[model samples]
Target: MRDVSLLAGVSRMTVTRVFIRPDHVLPETRERVQRAVLELGYVPDRAAGSLATQRSGFVGLVLPTLSNGNFAAMVEGLTEALRTAGYELLIGYTSYSVAEEERQVHTVLSRRPEALVLAASAHSATMRRQVAQACIPVVEVAELPDDPIGHVIGFSNYAIGRAAGDFLAGLGHKRIAAIGASSDGERRDLRGEARLHGFTDALLAAKLPADMVRMEGDIPFSFTEGARIMARLLDEAAPPDAVFAVSDLAAVGVLMECRRRNIDVPHDMSLLGFGDFEIGQQMVPALSTIAVDFDDLGRRTGELVAELLQHDDPSGIARTDVGFTLIPRGTTRASVP
Candidate 1:
């Protein structure tokens, strides 16, 4: 910073002001400083700046996993939004474990971030308390919480599940099976559970026997897991007429497996999935699934964090429900006799 300031013919304070409040500096002076910074490849010490101002200008982002395209997209959207606001994102992956999430939270909080954005609904009461004590803006993205720590900018997983189940039942799929993530690490499991309950109840209400319902697990909400479960079910003497995989990745796997086995989708079996990721549509037979507005989720989270940061009174809580839609495509069809 000192070298850049010298090269730009400005004081160190001028350079600092350029970053913190560029609007205060003359256009020519700002340009000269920026050019000097570029020429010298000099990076300002954001940490030092934070110490001086007590504002980190950084937002801590904690996600359950980067493996899922859905979460990855959400992160991308979030980072883009944060960057536009002149804030940097400090990211951490927790692999969906509450303990791991708590540990990551502690590590991120140590950095004194201006705000925090969590990908999943937190499970640990201790962790929740810790975040509250941090006294920073905390926003939970992707899934709605029963008790949000600060602000929420996501949808109800329960509603997504129920919607998927209702759509499948309305299509007259009497014997429905659900393939879901078996890991207890993520609150996403609650989505699978809710979908399962909704599917079963909807079927039962239609006079379909509860015994007709089949479920399989030991998956991590991926395409590979979905395919594996479908293979196991197909190997059985009586396969389900329709199956709902909790994730689009899993549904794609199911579709691939059916193709390999020469099983006709919506003819021999129907499939439904969640997330409605891009891959779902690119497949040979497009997936029928529940779609969450991940981009909206990201934007809303950013807005909520900004609100919490600017407000003196934290008493007002904002819960934005980014709703879900069921995309009916080629995968699910009317049951065949």
Candidate 2:
């Protein structure tokens, strides 16, 4: 900053004003200071500024996986919204592990972020304690929480599952099968488990036979695993006329397996999935699935963080349900007239 001021023929205060309150500086002076900064490749000391302002000017964001496009879209929305508020995101990945999430929370809190955004509601005991102790605004995204630490922005995974199940059942399909994560040690797979439960509830509500609803798959949710599960289900003595996967990737995997086996979709079996990922729409037979507005959820979470930051109130509007939608496409059709 001193060098920039010297180069721009201005005092250090002018340089500071250029960066902090550019509107207060003359346009030409601002341009000259900016040019000097660019020529010298000088970076402002955000840490020092934060010490004086007591504002880290950063929000920590924790994500489960970067492999999922839904999470990516949510990050995009949050990034844009936070950027608009002059705040940056410090990202952390938990890899679907509760213990790892606790570690990540500790690491992010060490950075002194003004706020934090988490991907899911489920958190380790240590993580919850650390977040509560931080005294920073926290936003939980993707899944709605029964008890939110701060603000929650997302839809109910079980309701999404119920909606998908109802849609398939309403299409006249009686024989239904579901594939999801078989394990939930740390409730990491809570989203998938909830969906499965909701789907079974819908099946029972419809008075479908016990034999008509088959819960298959004992592996984690993944494309290849979904394909393998679908293949194994097809080989069973009694195959389902329709299949619902807990994720869009798994649904696509099921479709891929059906294609390889020379099985006709909708004609022979109707398929549905959760998380209406983009690839599902571009498939030869468009996928039918439950869609959540991930970007909107992110935006709302960001907005909530902004509000909390400005107000410093934890009790203000603790939750926001972004909701979900059921989209039917070529992969599913009416099983009977």
Candidate 3:
């Protein structure tokens, strides 16, 4: 900053103003400073600037993984919103482990972000306590919590699950199975567990035997994993009448496996998936799944962070619930004898 200011015939304060309040500087002066910065390859030290302003102007974002398109879309929404609001985002990835989340929380907090946003549902009590102690605004995305640490912007995965289960039961799917991720890293597991409960409860309400339902492996959520699990189920002597994959990617895999085996979707078998990703509707036999407004979720998160920062609230705020919808497509139908 000093070198760039010197080369531009300006003071260090001018450089600081360029970053924090560029609107205050004249167009020619701003251009000269930027050119000097580029030529000198000088970078401003965020840590020092944050200390001077007593605010980081940086929001910390932590998520399970970016490999999922849904998550990627959420991130895109968040970064764009934050950038437009004159803030930068600092990101961290927690592989969906409680312990890892705890560690990442500490790491992000150490940076003194203006606010923090988490993708997965908070699990560990210790981790929650740490977030509470941070004294900064926190936003948990994707799934809402019964008890939020700070502000929450998400929907009810349980409700989504129940909706899917009831839909399938209404379609007369007596023999159903579920495939879900076992990892605690994702809050979507809560959705899976709730879906399983809803699926079983709905079947029982219809006088179907609990034993008629089958559930498979507790692995990471992925399309390939969904495909492999569906293949195994298809190999069984009495295959399930329908299958529900916790994620759209998993559903895609199931569809692919069924296609390879020459099985007719919604005819020989029925399939249901969650997360109405673009691919879900684009696939051959469009997936019958739940659609989550992830973009809205991200926008709400950004708004919450901005609100908290602007207000500088110490008492924190209440959790916010977004909502979900079920998208019924060609993948599910009445079981054929």
Task: For each candidate in the order shown, give its overall lDDT on alpha carbons.
Answer: 0.78, 0.83, 0.78
- Sorted on lDDT, best first, the list reads 2, 1, 3
Which candidate achieves the best lDDT against the true structure?
A: 2
Best by TM-score: 2
Any runs in candidate 3 off by more than 4 Å, and if so which? Answer: 6-9, 23-32, 183-188, 212-215, 314-318, 334-337
lDDT for 245 (candidate 2): 92
Cα lDDT for residue 202, candidate 3: 66
Candidate 2's TM-score reads 0.92
Per-residue lDDT tens digits for candidate 2, residues 1-337, read: 7899999999999998876667899999999999999999999999998786787889999887777888899988898888887789999887777787888889999999999998775777788889999988888887777877767788888887788778878889877888887654653666787888888888888877435333454434778878988888899888888999998888999999999999999799899998888888988799988888888888878887887887855555577788888888999885555
Ranking by TM-score: 2, 1, 3
User: In model 2, which regions exceed 4 Å deviation?
Assistant: 21-28, 184-187, 209-220, 335-337
**Per-prediction TM-score:** 0.92, 0.92, 0.88
Q: In candidate 3, what are the lDDT values of residues 1-337, reduced to their tens digit?
A: 7788889999989988998889999999999999998998887787888888887888998887667777787887888788877888888876666677778888998989888998756568988887888887788888777776667787777677667767777777777777776643343355566666776776677776555344454545778888888888888887887877778888899899999999999897788898888889999889999887787778767876776677854464657777778777898764445
What does the lDDT read for residue 233 in candidate 2?
A: 84
